[model samples]
Target: MFWIDDLWKFGISAFVGTLTVFVPLLDTRTEALDPIPVVVTIPILKDLAEQVGGPYVRVTSLLSGYENEHTYSPKPSDLIAVRKARLLFEIGLGLEVWISSLVRNAGSQALRVVTTSQGVELIQDDADTHEHPHTGKHTTDPEGNPHIWLDPANALIMLRHITDALIEVDPSHEAKFKANEAAYRERLRQLQKELSDRTQRLPDRRFIAHHSAWPYLAKRFDFHIVGTIHLQAGTEPSALHLQSLIEKIRKEHIRVIASEIQLSQRLPELLSRETTARVVVLTTMPGGVPGTETYLDMLRYNVLQLVGALETT
Candidate 1:
């Protein structure tokens, strides 16, 4: 009877051990079917990926809408995110100067870098914008301005890139991805038309920009950019340039000065004090402001705010 009890104990122990090992294997298989990990340089790409990929992606954005994209420094956690990601989406055109080195350091051979700005017609700045003065590099691409996502039309192109990439990675979800992309595209077109109609009715459509970031937006909405405060990012305008802007604002009656939430408010505030032009703090990224948490929300908020300022002034 003692020998029988010992044999029963051994059998029970063996059964529990087998269950523990096999349970983890089953979990691993389920995890393999989990959402694809994605890393994007900016929030706009993250939003686009999530919109297109839906529940099929786990996306991480390196620069949360508040950071200056040109001057962003990657953190240790960013490397881990990149290493785990199968796809890394970037605005490209030299906007994210820090990304290439980060990816290299991550040493992820399985990672694929997708440039969302590819194939879209770019806007060449009449004057180049310098990178963060500390880095001593040109942030603006030699080819053109990399802020293509500012324009909803260009965002459509970006959405397409994300859609194609997601489909490539998860072919089983191809139909879902395409359907999501189509729905988003339709929403974008509808919003573009609505905003365009609103802007068309504006009596005054001219504004002085904080930086050379609005050409596409201006062109798309039929608004005019009278002057830019910072030709180079992360640097102050020369006294002479500021004086010239002041004079131009006074002379041209540029009632609205567009400034970004990501940049310092001191310059735009100073200008507002020196002139009658009101400063409207707008966001280039999706989550830069409280109400602007999505691409469509951002586009609407910016145009409406600008239009409201223009109409009031």
Candidate 2:
């Protein structure tokens, strides 16, 4: 006959053994609940992916907001991230010249590279006419400008691509992605309207861009990009071009020169000193500037800051 203590011991041992067997199973289930992994070429894409994917995605942006997208080189971690990701999002249009090689090297058979700029109408980089001092090569995209995300309308298009991609990879979360996308679109529209209303009040809307990144934004917001300081990436403008820009600003009374945080400020400042036009440093990427983390926030910040500068002049 078994004593009561023996039975108790037997029960405890059985419970322990069962737990030991099931713990890994439980851990696997928990791990399965984790979000899908994704990688994006830039911070703006990361924001869009997160907005649409919500809790369903774990996104890593290869280029932080502070880096120049044209000149970015993928780090080893970027390759690792690409290898692990189910999807990789980029603006395309030759924006990330280095991304293709990285993807090839990553050898991620499951990874889908989604070009978010697929359907949107592209703006030609007219700055190509100005010769770059170093390479003398045109930095402009032969197809179209890669800085399409600078405009809110283009952002909506990009967001749709992100939503579609997320749904494609994780169909289980389709409803969530669609719903989040709709909510984000509504908010984006509201911000666009608000900014439009504010911009309409401006008497003069001409500015000099640091680079060719602003054509889409300028077109969307009805602002005029009177001139560009650097026509090519990683190249300096000629003295003649600088003198021309100074003459243009002085002659046209171009009140604002919009400089990017990612680019050097010396030229803009020098131009400012040469003329009455004030330099308002803005960012092409989200989180490149404080109070500009979200896409909407960055849009508002850029528009409002430029409006403020234009108004003051």
Candidate 3:
């Protein structure tokens, strides 16, 4: 009887393991998948994924707007998201370095890992390769720019990639996907007009960023990044670096010290105090903060924040 019980226990364990591997790929079908557990690293992607997935799939963002997306370390819940997710969408371009490890650990080959920036042909910048603010090669895409989302023009392209993946996973909602993509693109188009109109008239387009995070936006709006507090994404600024920036501030007559909500505002705040510059919080994603819940609102909020800082202080 003891032998029988032991055999039963072993068989149950083996069977459970086998099912876990095969069921989600084969038999496990849910009523709706629009909200499939999607693990995105950025908030804008989080919003976009939810838009494309609609009511059928559930989505989750691994990195919140409050932290640096480029320098984030993976958490346990992130691994859990990978384990449960049927399809994984990432920014790619080596944006999320921890992705490979998470995928391997989850051991789910059935999981679809889609790079949202696949077709954009990224922009390249090697001049300041001394260090990069993000992961991988110091200089960004030789093919094109990784910050494709900044250009609303590219968001239309991204929609195709996102919609195609959603379709592949769940073809039943093909029409709904198309409709959703179109609606989202139209909204983005309006946002492009709103952002472009506002930035066109600014007298001085010079600003200081903690890191080189705004090149994509700068190129479109004709804004210049005089210098970065920290050139590399993860490295902290040294005292010498701070002194140099203060000097740059005086020489350039730059008034706004821009800080991202994701990184340490303490440093930016200190620099602002030293230089008599006003500190502005910029959002890199949609719904990154409480107020900037949509992509349009996110860009507007960032631009408005910058404009306000430049105008008032």
Candidate 4:
């Protein structure tokens, strides 16, 4: 009877030892599979983060490209996302004016806010004149235009910042992050060259912009921005301004009017009706339109669509 009891005790001891040895290993594996939680202010940042972070990050974008970034009101879910995120990326230069309050409300102790626009060259806008007429909403940044992502070259700067932040948070995946960035960089350069070459053959590269979102893109692709329909977002150009633009468009033969999908098409359509210029609907953000889901796709779609319109009209 005593020998049988001793054998039972030994069996229990062996099982306990096996559990102690295997439990942590299983836990470690599960922990490794859990991705880093990231929050971004705009879809473009989300795309850049995902491109660099790859499987290492789970990103949530506050603005889904459909919303006007300047006028966006943060949702409850946005607060929750910020609270859960280790890294929060923004274009910074005052583009996301609501982000500070959102992050403050989140009360995340461990959250690090990364401004990708830190080292990039900024384009200044007429902040005084660009205020929304109705709501008095300030559209342009006093610091600079926060649309740096419109240029592929600036996008590369943003990508580098994203990679650095990702590496800082998840140092174990540094090689993967760098590699992904390099690959995407090459792709961006190739696309940039392709677009440049295409634009080179165009006789008329001038257009009337829907808003002040095209300066960076225009600089990159050599397209001339003849006039802007809405100097300030959510504010309509006056009849006098519209008349002036119509006259300019007809005189300059600015065949293309670059309007964004995020904006109301009424003004652009009006311009088209008044003049021979064709409105080529473009997107400033990824996922703003079908087939422009990624940064590269949006860049290609914008340039090619504008080019097609310019050439045909």
- Relative to the true structure, candidate 1 reaches a TM of 0.91
Model 4, CA-based lDDT: 0.88
**Which lDDT values do the candidates have, in the order given?**
0.90, 0.89, 0.75, 0.88
Question: What is the descending lDDT order?
Answer: 1, 2, 4, 3
TM agreement with the true structure for every prediction: 0.91, 0.89, 0.84, 0.87
Better of 3 and 4 by lDDT: 4
Model 1, residue 28: distance off in Å is 4.4
- In candidate 1, what are the lDDT values of residues 1-313, reduced to their tens digit? 9856866878977867878999999999988789999999999999999999999999999999999988889999999999999999998877888999999999999999999999999877764334523234554535677788999999999999999999898999999999999999999999999998899888899999987788899889999898899887767789999999999999999899999999999999999999999999999999999989999999999999999999997
| Candidate 3: tens digits of C-alpha lDDT, residues 1-313 | 7966866878877867976998776644543523556677677777787777788777888876776767678899889988888777777776677788888998986788888887775666446554444654545335333566766666667667878888888888889988998898888888778877888778777888876667777776677778788767787778998998899898878888878876778888888888877788887777556788876677778777777776664
Winning candidate number (TM-score): 1
Pairs with steric clashes in candidate 1: none
How well does model 1 score by local distance difference test? 0.90
lDDT score of residue 98 within candidate 1: 95
